[model samples]
Target: MTPIQALYYFVEARPTRTGPPNVGIGAILLIVAAAVFIAWVAWLWIAARPSSGGEETALNLQPYLSDDELETTKLNRVLRAAM
Candidate 1:
């Protein structure tokens, strides 16, 4: 009816802004993103695992010892006990 309304309608071509001009993004991109995220998380999880090696070294830390360090350790323990 008004000149400004007519001009606006003609310029806009559409009455209201369409949410989207057309459909949407394809599913492939979403799938790729999910795969990449999963792979990244898996790599981080694997890298975080402890890689402690040498069973003999681990056993040396225990109380049972056939080495000379055990005598000094026992003496220290006795001194602490005496104190």
Candidate 2:
């Protein structure tokens, strides 16, 4: 056979087979990075939430009074200002 015919025969003789789709390295890394970012944001959101029962312990009452005292003080101040 001639060289051109042999080349054409060689090209057509290969088997045609379907294969699994390929996933790029960048796509895999992007998925992993997105998952990590979501986890990080979730952690930050959870950490930033107000802690119940912890506010009372963190409050210092030296410069402030109880709610009853504050109301009475406000009333007295208003009365004094009205005079």
Candidate 3:
């Protein structure tokens, strides 16, 4: 047989000296980097986005709760305190 054939046979027949390399950390790091990059791009895209034709300031969200809701909250707080 040719030298190349002998080498191939030896390599194929011999057992591998080392088991599969540990790539979990590298894969996790790669995923984390990709996520971070994606997040950064999304943040930049949102920041540089053009504003709609409207008021510059955003509306505040503040709706007062009903009396019954307040009373229920108070009762829950009291029960929590008792516990």
Candidate 4:
């Protein structure tokens, strides 16, 4: 009569089937989905590959500006404005 007992009974009870279980379409769909996913990943990997003839650009970093100094300067400006 309790909720747990009812749930347990529901899970334990099996319905009588007149025919065989149909899983052929489901299996085929699963295989197709897996193949599509793999193909997509392979395509992305191939498309994103860097060209052999392209030259790599050098990164330019400012030597005069330090991150810590920049942060301190911003904090000082905010504090001065607040005062």
TM-scores for candidates 1 onward, in order: 0.34, 0.40, 0.38, 0.38
Pull out the clashing pairs in model 1: none
Residue 80 Cα positional deviation in candidate 4, in Å, after optimal superposition: 65
Candidate 1 lDDT over residue span 1-83, tens digit each: 89999998898896776586554566667888999999999999999998876546566576776567767888789989999
Give the C-alpha miss distance for residue 68 in model 3, angstroms. Answer: 53
Native-to-model Cα distance after best TM-score fit, residue 75 in candidate 2, in Å:
43
Q: Write the per-residue lDDT of candidate 4 for residues 9-66, one digit (tens) a residue.
A: 9988968779967767889899999999999999999999988977656556436568
Candidate 1: C-alpha lDDT: 0.82
lDDT of 1 at 79: 89
What is the Cα-based lDDT of residue 47 in candidate 1? 97
Sorted on TM-score, best first, the list reads 2, 3, 4, 1
Model 2: per-residue Cα lDDT at residue 13: 100
Could you give candidate 2's per-residue lDDT for residues 1-83 as a string of tens digits?
99999999999999876885588788899999999999999999999998785445446555667789878988799999999
Residue 81 of model 3 has an lDDT of: 100
